[model samples]
Target: MWNTRFRLIFISSSTYSALGLLPMRPCSSSDPKPGCCPPSPALKTGAWHSHCARSASPAELCRFRSLGPGTSGDTGSAAIESVQGAKNVDIIVLLPKGHCTKIQELQMTTVLRENVHVFGVEGNSDELDEPIKTVFADVAFVKKHNLMSLNSINWSRVLVQIAHHFFAYFRCAPSLDMHPLPPVEVVVPTGAAGNLAAGCIAQKMGLPIHLVVAVNSNDIIHRTVQWGDFSLSKAVKPTLASAMDIQVPYNMERIFWLLSGSDSQVIRALMEQFERTKSVSLPKELHSKLSEAVTSQSVSDEAITQTMGRCWQENQYLLCPHSAVAVSCHYQQVDRQQPSPPRCCLAPASAAKFPEAVRAARLTLDTPAEILALEHKEARCTPMRKGDDWTRMLRDTIEDLSQQWQRRFLNLPA
Candidate 1:
């Protein structure tokens, strides 16, 4: 696994290009440039997990925290395991109660680490982010506590995800010898638009990629791409692909900034409008640019099930609902006899994480023995009820943890 010494810095539009953290040019040749890029932390580390804590002094307590709406359970589970036994680091994850599948919830709540804090919030995943954002907004508090967020809002997460597009391009490209590398189609099943934003960045860096944004019933991203209607629906629809059930794809602003030639002013104005009205018609010119950069489709619950069953029947490979959403787009392309480049469907979760989806597909569940054992483990999670001031609670928790660390460091009573 790759580890970097740098701490998480919230990237802004003006500074992202200047940071030069990623490549600006496309691949020079087809031979799959050996070490063209470093392995992304998401793959080497864990979902939304950062190595910032590793750089802390022995006596200092570094906190790596995240807010997750708990779609598939992978992010919380991975984040928890990444710092399971680290003495100087703690991970605090907030997951929406009853929103995730039982297995997904168990995977996180069953962890018995002293430094791991999992909260079952009585709200949607999107609602959980508000309090975390509020806490992180406090510059002094964050600096004093050595706090870092391993969420999509953090640039590192997006930076790591960029590697996926490059790897997929190299794997699927038919030839490297041509003057320009052969284009490949990347089908992304996304929510919050983090991975989609990464793909857009990859394309900007000269990767010859056609991005197909795949979504389930929550089709705001699809609608925006297809019709330039950047507006939220009445409500987020629950689907088999629960993780992709997002009304607002927040990362679209990043994509807009990149595609608009890093025009931060225009993006800021547009986003301000969106925030104020919960809807905005994209400028004709920007909408045109977005359409050229990516195609989109919204898969239905029925299609997710059919695609899952079809994959199992044809290839003996079970797919999670989220993955099936992307595959469903691919199937549509083939069924219509559309000419397309080599396509790679990004599967962001495992079928084992969602036995309910597997059952919906009429496929035998293939959960591992270790995963099956989670149910019997002692489970624990703090509840954030409807009337609670979640933001204040989060602040209090962080302060409490910091105080506890200080007490232990001084050999004082708990």
Candidate 2:
């Protein structure tokens, strides 16, 4: 619940050193540090949810305007187009099956320069139950290709990058008028913990990163997080925030690193602190760095849909399901004016990516222009029938792209 007088946080050159270049710090905080903790090394495994995996489920999640009472900002809606120029250059898109849409896949894959790489992460959302566990499975799958895991475990670096980017983005932002030295706090939607974990590291760098975590009713983060206590179990299912859909975020290591006080003696102390903190919830020192955590407060499938449509009506914008969950919950809270700090939300992905979720949201939108534009949007998809089958389908996608590349670039064969 820490609110900052500043609106932007930046990273000086020194911050980069802490990411890895600089040596560790001594373990000393004014407050007494917590005890140590350890976790089981064994990872659980399960099958892909293939049954109806291919079925076209709800493809969209909405950010609504609340046509009625209880809506947040969005002065007006004008069938907003769901496009944001590339947020990052070196983007690593982890595409899971049954969870991605044709537009999303293409938006991720087609819009890339040589710097961007999109890989098909062979996975099934419904079957796995927890996306976090499946991340290692995907890592294992990628290891065969000789690439190391870039999963959120690598968040230490991402946070470093984002922290530095905050300096640049905010300095260039209209709010700051290209000014210098504005105190900044960042609120990010936490998923595999990479986003939040990296965010905390950035906070250490002086970006004042805030983890405005949005969870579904499933209560994975909310239930697991604690100040003096240990983190809770792996995960729970069927929550509103699907993308925050992870249970056992692999970025726990990075979090442990951030909360451990100092790099020098932090691990040993944290390991010991974790002893009592294990099996319950993450200690407050670590979770508090996240800044704030909010559940879409019992968001339902229908509520998500309406929220999405309302976003279009009010802001001329559309948000995907996961983003919708975040926006809806966030907006609902703002309507109450909870007297907390002003929360800034980021739409991590585009709404068009999830067509079904959009369809649901569109019900509330009801405008002819919004509906027609949605129906006629240029969508591209591989149409995988199941999640497990994506691996084989990936090869076909590569071949098809290769042919397209040749035809477009070489101008040879039909």
Q: Clashes per prediction?
A: 2, 49
**On a 0 to 100 scale, what is the lDDT of residue 293 in model 1?**
98
> Could you give candidate 2's per-residue lDDT for residues 351-388 as a string of tens digits?
43355666655543333353344445543223334345
Give the Cα error of residue 361 in candidate 1, in Å.
1.1
Question: Scored by CA lDDT, what does every candidate get?
Answer: 0.72, 0.39
Off by over 4 Å in 1: 1-52, 55-72
Best by TM-score: 1
Q: Against the hidden true structure, what lDDT does model 1 obtain?
A: 0.72
Kindly report which residue stretches of model 2 are placed more than 4 angstroms away from their true locations once superposed: 1-95, 102-146, 155-157, 164-185, 226-241, 263-278, 283-303, 338-343, 363-414
Write out the backbone clash pairs for model 1: 30-176, 69-125
Best candidate per lDDT, number? 1
TM-scores vs. true structure, each candidate: 0.86, 0.50
RMSD of each: 8.6, 16.3
Q: Alpha carbon lDDT of residue 332, candidate 1?
A: 80
